[model samples]
Target chain A: MKEHKKLPSAVIKRMPRYYRYLTTLQQMGISRISSRDLGNRMGVTASQVRHDFFSFGASGLQGYGYDVDLLRQEIRDIFGLDDLFSVIIIGAGNLGHALAKYSGFEKNGYKIAAIFDVKPEIIGERINDIEIIHLDKLQEYVQDNHVDIAALTVPEIRVLEVAKLVTDNGIKALWNFSPIELLASDDIVVENIQMIDSLMVLGYNLRTAEAKLNPN
Target chain B: MKEHKKLPSAVIKRMPRYYRYLTTLQQMGISRISSRDLGNRMGVTASQVRHDFFSFGASGLQGYGYDVDLLRQEIRDIFGLDDLFSVIIIGAGNLGHALAKYSGFEKNGYKIAAIFDVKPEIIGERINDIEIIHLDKLQEYVQDNHVDIAALTVPEIRVLEVAKLVTDNGIKALWNFSPIELLASDDIVVENIQMIDSLMVLGYNLRTAEAKLNPN
Candidate 1:
């Protein structure tokens, strides 16, 4: 995050892969690893791993892959995941309920400090021991819990209102699952994940890949 | 797909952006656009558009950016969105139901043809008018529906077993939202999307970015 060109999005995208592979190595009690071995686990060529690492800088020893603990710590620093992140979910619908209980967040270093819902039925209800609070308390909860980022799984039509709420509540970044694109300022970084659109991308790639492999 | 060197996975990732832009233009009834204009809408440098298009041996007219209709259709061909891609959702959970009703799928040329679940209460129930069939019927339903892609939003404990079923049903592609990785072959494509991991990525990036800008 120094005064320099931003980390390439592609490089940032690879952080999860690096984290996953590092986690595996740590589990095996391996302290050091070579780029080739890391590449083997990641399905990328070793040279490619080295290239990506070189692009982002790494703590790996030359010809030695990486020091397990140092590499893990270094990658965490690079990803900025070393610190705890406070997250607030902006919807308490069925999707939100599943997301609240989804253990994936805990493993990847995201702490769900609060869940927001406008539904009278869901408000005050607890899922996975996390209480669903009324949306009216969003700003207070966000400030109280030091929430830096939030994710919205609200209906498409209601996204703008919730987005405004997130901004007013001091949220810096947002992961929006609603299909509609919410307008936000340059200060507000928003990532829209239209799931169906994602499926189309993968589906199209799958077909294109299949056709290339089996030309008629 | 016609004898092109495998496009970088990164390229595959960005096709959706291009697709979205094109769709937006189509919806607006815009007939033509230039590279600069397209680049502006896509949030990429103009040169990037030219370079990315050239990678596919495709480009818009020199003076005019691209013919709206031609480019739209060509992008589809590039991404293979023209083909029918039948999708199966494993886990008839709330999230799965919301995904089934997600309008972006059919809007963008992918179809959710089947929903599989283990819960007896939900089995045979209708979701978005799509039947929530039993898990016991998965393989047969997949074959019957000619489904070739599967999305796993199941419980983490059941992920591996359900993933095995999906691949055994001859699905060439699988999307894993569970925290567990779904094992696959070089021939089969599996994209694992851990929800919480995405939140962490957002948090980490935001903090790193903020720290770099405000050296406190």
Candidate 2:
């Protein structure tokens, strides 16, 4: 892979969306797609699509458009999706169970290696054949396995301590679902799934759309 | 509330983050905050914070900075959170159950009015005191009640059909958790919670951070 300069955060955020659209096209057996068509599907202008692709060094043929498979592969490489990532869930609550039972992540090379919780009743149970271990075993498990990501589904009160334990054990990335914001070291990557925030945004948009129609 | 111009999409997206941070500060009894301090907490520049607030006509005092409660209330009003929104879950699976059990949405005024499922076994069950109704009853339920949002947690195969049912019943907003993107009408709002996309971004960031450290 070429050593490309770091793309802007906006472009980085859109890469996964592009990858998803391209995957859909690939699955449909469409080998090529015009920028205009792809952009329409993605709710963006053709020039915006072209600019995003250009940032990543992908150029379409003048008349024939871009190769679906090639563009998907390039995005896959950029996201390092070709490699398998071992993920451990830090809480065995409903959200944790949902993540463990979700088959999408495993299909995309993100394997749920283990799940840990402080509750004794749920510990030792299995979700998708992966046993839920006690929180006490987290450090030992991280040391024994090559874990790439720690998905923090713990409660807000316990999330900070759990994050510290994970980072202390050399985990470099955190996919936090906890309501609180985590302050992690610069080297560690934290991706917070603020579901409430998303809901609030949807609410705002719905209100905006309604106001436009009523205008009262 | 005074009428304001439609904020930029980028600013609209960041509103929830600002709300979250301000909520935290309010809980901490921090009545006033400088743009620099708020910006640091949100991982943005002070000017960026100022710009977003300015877009919404929220101007901070030159010497005293912003009032935490006032800014949060402004954002809440902008998001229309003062009014309770009736929400229904479209699937009774693990993801749906998680959404139904989540107390955050209700705390923020998005009530899970009911949950619907096609399956016979799980249809009548309760999650967080909200009864799961049969999917066949969805149309009747929507007609009887004013539901603002339908949280789609059904499988990808069933999502489109369920979405069609929800929209056909006049629900204007969809909080979609299914992997597939739902194409809604121009006036309807669709917020997709693509967990896989988020995981991929985390993976990419992890890879980039590791590459910076090890350059191989």
TM score of chain A per candidate: 0.87, 0.96
* Candidate 1 Cα deviation (angstroms), residue B71: 1.2
What is candidate 1's lDDT per residue for A1-216, written digit by digit as tens?
223345677776776777777887899899888888888777788887777777766646767667878767766666556466777888887777777887766666677778898888878888888888999987678657788777898887888888887887778898988877554455777667656556755665577668767877
True contacts kept of 1: 0.48
iRMSD per prediction, in order: 2.9, 1.4
> Mind giving the per-residue lDDT tens digits that candidate 2 earns over B6-104?
778788998988988898899999999999999898788999999999999999999999999999989877887879888898888788877877768
lDDT measured at residue A95 in model 1 versus the true structure, 0 to 100:
76
By DockQ, the best candidate is 2
Best by lDDT: 2
For residues A1-216, write the lDDT of model 2, one tens digit per residue. Answer: 335677887899988889889888988999999999998988899999999999999999999999999999888777777788889999888889889988788768789999999889988899999999998987789778899999999878888888989898999999999888776567999899999988988887888888899899
Q: List residue ranges in candidate 1 displaced over 4 A.
A: A1-6, A55-57, A181-185, B1-8
Which candidate has the highest TM-score of all? 2
> Each candidate: how many clashes?
6, 0
Model 1 quality (TM-score): 0.91
